[model samples]
Target: MKNLGKKIIIIFSLLATAIYANVVAKVYPKNVVSGEVATYTLTITGGEVNKPVISTICGSNVLGTSSQTSIQMINNDYKKSYVLSYQFMPQKNCVIAPVNVEVDGRMEQSNSVKVTVKPAVQDKNADFVVNLIPSKTKLFVGEPFNLQLVLKQKKDAEAVDSKFIAPDFKGFWVKGESQATRTEEGDFIITKAMYRLAPQREGNLTIQPAQLKIATRISSRDVWGGFMPQVKWKSYFSNEGHIKAKPLPNNAKIVGNFTISATADKLEINPNEAVNVTVKVVGDGNLEDIKSFKPYIPDVNVFDEKINIKGNTLTQKLAFVSDKDFTIPPFSLAFYNLKTKRVEKISTQPIHIKVNGAVKKTELKIQRDDSIKTSEKSLHVTQKREVLSKVWIVAAFVAGLLIGILIMLFVKPVKFLKKEKALNLNDEKLLLIKLLPYKDKDEEVKKIVDVLEANLYASKKEKIDKKILKEILKKYDIS
Candidate 1:
């Protein structure tokens, strides 16, 4: 009976222990270096437990959180344990305050842990270092350049399992190439990457440091003449750099090395016909800056299609229409060339076209003359026949006049004159009125007219650009 009672008491004690929860706190790496990560774990055992909530820890920044659970059968009783971990980055040498947590509706506290943050460890015997190199440090806004991320290592070291972390390019546009090239020198091995970067903002810009995580193998000879090797992993960082981007003058937008050229499918065509014009730009810089290649020509219909970019080439296609022969003015683009260090201008050649008038009807005139002769001969016929012939001739004359009026309205007779009467355009205002197209109020036309008037009437005669007069005539649908 005594043994039976003792066994019952022990079983009850075990049950009571299992029914309650046990909690404790643990800190890893009591000593740490500044800027290093430290781990803190909260352990819970026995009965079921909710997740532990962590309190803020001083002198450290919480980086992340994680949790784990496990179950075991001990002495015919089920036991469970849970671990909640928090990762923190220590800023300096200081005492970490006690962390408070709640588990299973009970508040639990962890003991304070002291951390000795020492200076960062450096190895001067390192075999290699990573570098971020740029093609140029100074640039104008909207200018583009190349950047290289390189890992240069000594010949004695072998690099393996290399990983890279790129910097945050906040104010720049970056085009990155994925493949990394490996090259070997006489005493070094290099891994490199190429990238194209364009500054999106003006003023001072900084590129953050790049990181490289790599493992290297070193071989040594043992005392017994046998080779012993060891593999170690280390992280390397590249220096942070700055780029000075200057603002453009007069709000100039384009910057690069480029050439502009234009071509037309048909230079000459009838009125209301459309001609296809294609403009091409070939260069090594930002081709996307040329978003449009549309030129506004007076009295001509212009329709611009989408801009196409393939490789280093940019092409824009447009359709043009006019009612008379016209010369499309030369198109010019002004840009700063980084290589030449000067503002250069490129322009397309002027395009000229001829428009032919509608064909005239000579047969109608011949018919009218024959009808007049027949009427004159009718005088010798009988009186009844003469009367009928006279009526028919009058009717033909009226019909011909009506047809001529309709032709005049369709052909716009004023524009068909071979030469202008000087008396009709004695006033400069009259000349401008005749030259201005109803649909065009272009400033270029007005400026040309002013120059023409000054050259023809000013005290000092200046040579006027004859091309301007020719353009004005075509714009108004005049011959």
Candidate 2:
């Protein structure tokens, strides 16, 4: 009977201990970037009908609590849960502080949480990635603008909604939103927000709450803690906020239009010669529209050459021509000049060219006196040829007289003397004939025979050169 009473007492003590452990409120997930909404969860167990109240106060320059949310509930106990989300847009960087989440605003039985609002980490492939197209980091007022939201999900992640709460535009509005596209990289990206600014005001603004909800993966493994391991939930907050666009200034500065100017090394030129006209484009705005100055030039035929472009400076050579007097007119300069507060129109001075005559017309014609002198010189050659013909006739007369003297001396009264001369010649010939019959070939007889043959009978018409005579004599066996 005493053992049964002891067992009853042991069971009562164990039941009473489990009765007191009730509602617990905790704030977790410590790291967060500015403008990211974070969730704080409340778990209650072993409690009666006790109402719970949650409130928050945002830190100055750290977080603004004025815009934070609040909620109260009356039915609790038996493992009930509650969730609240808030954000901190830190004005400055590196201010690590704690946020106050008051549960019933009392410390005795109430709970409080301390968290750090830090910067966000860059996530390369996020579920809902906000893309600033053309990513024009630098913008002007009333500029055509657009933004793209890229959503990537694994097969198990939940569907996303673009109706998520977003920032407020104080001085701007969206111009258009492009059709969404699902790229092969497994992403659904829809271009949104073609924005432009209103006429004037200028200041930096923020897109308050850019929110996105995505499914979180759950795993099963029992652990001992206040964490409630198996409990599953989905939804979220994103660090990528919206449009911090500033309006262009009301009194913006205006830049001047490009101007073209002409310069020459010198103004004078010879006829049929060339002069170079150089045009320099100086100043700002679009320098591409300036045409070649050659076409606009008059009297001068401009030559085109390869243009030299260096940064904003443009230069090229222009060559011109004319036989008579001509001028290169000054070009007009029109630009939105910042000085003098108006568009200025200016003209350059006209350039003058003097071309001297090359050859006089009188000098171009042939003279009659010179033509006659040259023609007479040509006739003089015929006159000389006529005189040469008369000389040849006199030479023939002299040759006939020489032949007549020879014939007269031998044929008439000179016959007796011819017979006597022949006898003398026969006697000399006898010497050669006697030597030929003997074939002795003595050096003295060889010399005498060579002289006789050269004078009397070798058939070649050219002068009997001594070399051929000597060789013929040697071949006749006469040394």
Candidate 3:
């Protein structure tokens, strides 16, 4: 009888525990390739609980987490449940460690999960193959190289949908990429994409594999005894690539063959007028690494424009405004010449400008006429001098009034004019034009201008926040 009583008590305790709470862990898509994202969910039911603090999952970093809660009326009792999900990218196959969740002031353990992370698969018998090939794997920093992605497919196999995911290209600057081109090679059709890469840092870097997802169309019989179209999707991955970037010589900012030249619109200008000079650098290497040329001259107001890069050429416009003659010093660019296998320097000729209406200091001399001894003669001379002074003063006043009137009528205040020409934030191209002048002066402006320019000119497009743009315009009083 005592044994029966103990059994009854044990059953009641188990039922109470079941009514309190339960925790379970689950992983979706049990098998995945390395570098693929997988979802791990921890479900807690029948009680209140705190968020689970999971440091890692499947020996990989957790990218992010989210939670969802729900309430259900089961058997006339309110039952609450919580589901917490974690997103992680697994690099290898590993077992997920069990996590403990605190529920109603008590800790409940969850079951472990096993995940299979296999290396990227490339089907040998597939209809298509992709490859990532580099022009040269070994190079110096700032040296540009070509990386090409090529895909070859059988002409008979037609895909209904296709997407190509390029490598991340970490630690390297993507100078540019060419549009994909298709050509027929014997029995196969070939598609190729070329990218220009410049290493930003010296090290051994790995370029992750690129992926191509394709969907092929197939026919299936429907219930109506008619053929229906079906789609089957498959993914193909390219082989990984490695790059060994060696360090450049100390203080070597560029690597390639380049030439520097300067030209001025006019050698002579009036006082306060600007001398517009263009400094251009033409090269076959990493032209994007070239910095803007800022010529330093005392008493000269130098306004350096943003650097403009077009293919192998870089151009920077500079305005030097001064009341006196000043020399636009020669600009020099130093680069490691790949052909010569040595550091080389190129410089522009110094340009000397002449100010046509510059003011010059001259000594004035005063002489008294010793021959004028008579008082009447002296008085007449003094009256004549006074009359001349009055005439000069009147003439000066008249000229000043005319100039002020002309300025008021023709030239408006810069700030007021800019406000009047306030830009529509929605018009990115116009905003880009307005922001270009300020890019060299402000870092924030430069960043925004870069994004806008990329959206308009480059193949890749980036999102622009109107609120942020408006704030920047307001901050700079650019309207």
Best by TM-score: 3
RMSD each, Å: 29.9, 23.3, 34.9
Name the runs in model 1 displaced over 4 angstroms.
1-42, 52-67, 70-79, 85-102, 105-128, 153-162, 175-179, 186-188, 214-235, 249-251, 264-276, 286-288, 298-311, 319-329, 351-479
Instruction: Select the stronger candidate by TM-score from 1 and 3.
Output: 3
> Residue 68 in candidate 2 has what lDDT?
17
What count of clashes does model 1 give? Answer: 0
Candidate 3 lands at a TM-score of 0.55
- Per candidate, the number of residue pairs that clash is 0, 2, 0
> On residues 232-338, what C-alpha lDDT tens digit does candidate 1 reach at each position?
55556677768999886656777888888989999778878898989999886666666687888877789999998776688989988887777877877788887
Query: Would you give me the overall lDDT of model 3?
Result: 0.85
Clashing pairs in 3: none
Writing each residue's lDDT as its tens digit, candidate 3 over 271-320 gives: 99999999999887788788888967988999999999887889999999
lDDT of 3 at 227: 97
Per-residue C-alpha lDDT of model 2 across residues 1-479, encoded as one tens digit per residue: 99999999998886664344233334444554555545444443322233433343334332322221223343562343333333333322333233233334432242455556664443546555543333443444433344444444444445533345443445544434455556444345443543322212235544343445443445564222233333233333434433443432333322244566788766666786776778777654323334565655554577878776554566777777776667877766554454444556655567777667743345433687788888999899889999999999999999999999988877777655554332123343454564464335556556666666655566423333456445544555433
Taken over the whole model, the C-alpha lDDT of each candidate is 0.73, 0.49, 0.85
